[model samples]
Target: MDQAAAGMQGAHRAPVCYRHPDRETGVRCTRCERPICPECMVSASVGFQCPACVRGGSDTGPAPAASRPRTIAGGTVTADPRLLTKVLIGVNLAVFLAQLAVGSSLTDRFELIGQAQFSLFSPVQGVAEGQYYRLLTAMFLHSPTNYTHILFNMLSLWWIGGPLEAALGRARYLALYFVSGLAGSALTYMVADPRLPSLGASGAIFGLFGATGVLMRRLNYDLRPLVALLVINLIITFTPGFNISWEAHIGGLVAGVAVGYAMVHAPRERRTVIQYGACAVVLAVVVVLTLVRTAQLT
Candidate 1:
C-alpha cells in the first residue's frame, strides 16, 4: 500500500485518536491529521475535525484566511477615465463654433479668431502684453475656413492619442499635448512670424505622431503604416496652396520624439527624472528662441 494508505490503516487500527495521543480519543481531525474525543470533534465540509483545530486553522491559515487583494504594480489600483482628450476636443470644437458665430469670412475668421499677427488678428503685441496667452490659446483654435485642418488633427488624435493616453494615463498625455503644442508655436514664431497670428492643433497632433513612433519602436510594433501616414501628411503640409504650418508641425514632431524617447524608451527605473528633464529643456530652448525672434521683429 502507499504510505498515505498505510498511515490511514494504522490510524484506524488504533482506538486512540490520532491527535490526542495521550488520551483514548475516538475522532480524527480531517485537515491536520489530529485526533479528538467525540466531545471535541465537529463536522466540516470534508470530514470531522477537533473544534479547536478547525477554529485556529481558520484564523491562522488558508482554511478561512482573508483573501489576498489583487495588485497592479504592487498596489491596489483603480481605473482612470480618459478625460484629457475629451476636454481638448471639446475646447477646440467650442472655439471653432465660436469663430463661426462671429461675422467674418472663412479665411478672415480663421486669421482673426484662430491666431495671427497681433496687428492682424488682435490689438496687442509683445510677450508681456495680455496677448501672450495667444502662445497657448492658439493651439485650441483651428482654421474655420478649412475642414481638413480639424478633420486631420482630430483623426490623428483618435488614432494616436488613444493608445498613448492608455499607456501614459490622462495627466501625462495632456502635458505632452500642451507642451508639444507650445513647442510648435514657438517654432513658428521663431521661423515664420511672431506678429502674424497662426493657430491649430496640428503641432500637438504631430507630437502625438512622434510619441506613437517611439511607442511602436519600444514595443516592437509594426511601424510601416505610421511612417507611410506621416510621409503622406508631411507631403500635404508642403504642397502649394495648403496654407499649413509646416514649421509648427516639424517643431511639435521633434518635441514629441524627444519626450517619447525619454518616457517610453528609457529604462523603467530612470524614466521619471529623464522624461521630465528632457521636456523641460526643450520647452526652455523654444521659449528662448521665440523671445529672441520676437525681439528682432520688434
Candidate 2:
C-alpha cells in the first residue's frame, strides 16, 4: 500500500517547463527557483538561471574591457595590455623624437651603412668596427626626412604586434623582434649596396607579418592574402621612388616565418623551451652570418 501511494505521488508530481508547457524539465533557476527549458536558461557565475532572473540579477557585471578586441590599421588589437608592444612603440617614438632634436649625427652613428661607409669606420677589422650596435638600434631609427616612415612603421607595429605578444608572451616576442631585426641587418650587411645606408623598423614590422602569417597558417588559414601583401610590399620596396630596404623586409619576413613556425609547432609540454631553443639557433645563424660578412669586408 505504501509503495503504491509513493508511485502515484511521483507520477502526479512531474513538472513542465514554464516557457514550453508541453516539455517536461527538472532544471530550476538558481535565483528564482522557477523551472526553465534549456533554451530559456542562461549560464551565470553561480549556476544556471532563467533569462528573466539573469536580466534582473544585481551580481552580474559587464564583460571585462581588458580582454576586448578592437580593429585598428590592418590588425586586430585587444585591450589585454601587451606590455611589449607598448614598450616597443614608446622606444621607437622616443628615438624618433631624439632624431628630430639632434640631426645627421645620430643617423651616422646608428644607421646600417653599406660596406663602403662601413670600411671607412675601420679598415682592418671585421664586423664594421665599433658599429655592431647598429644591427639592433637601426630598427628603431627611421628616415627622419620623412614623417611617413615612422608613422607607417608604428601603425604596422600596433596592428600586428598585440596578437603576437599576447600569444608568445613578453620575452619571446621581444626575442622575435630583435632576432628578425638583426637578421634583416645581417642580410642588409651582405646584400645592400656598399654606398647605401639603411635605417627603419620595416624589418621588425615585417617580422610581425611573418610571425602572424605562421600563426594563421598553423590555424589553417589561407596564405594567399599574406603572400599578396608580401608581393605588394616587395614591389613598394623596389618601386624606384621610395628608398626602401627590400633586404631587411625579406630577411625579417623569412626569419619571422621560420621562428613563428617553430613557436607554434613545438610540443605542448615543452613549448616554451623549444621555442626559445629555436630562436637561439636562428640567432646563432645570424651571428655566424655577420661574422662571415665582416670577414669578407676586412
Top lDDT: which candidate number? Answer: 2
Identify the runs in model 2 with alpha carbons over 4 angstroms from their true place: 1-79, 116-127, 222-225
Q: Please write out the lDDT profile of model 1 over residues 125-244, one tens digit for every residue.
A: 444332455667778777777878888788778777865665555556776888888898888877874445677898999999998788667544568999999999899989999778
Per-model TM values vs. the true structure: 0.67, 0.69
True-structure RMSD, every candidate? 18.7, 15.0
Model 2 gets an lDDT of 0.73
lDDT accuracy of residue 235 in candidate 1: 99
- Cα misplacement distance, residue 133 of candidate 1 (Å): 1.5
lDDT of each: 0.66, 0.73
In candidate 2, which residue pairs get closer than 3 Å at backbone N, Cα or C atoms, i.e. clash?
none
Give the CA lDDT, 0 to 100, for residue 51 in model 1: 39
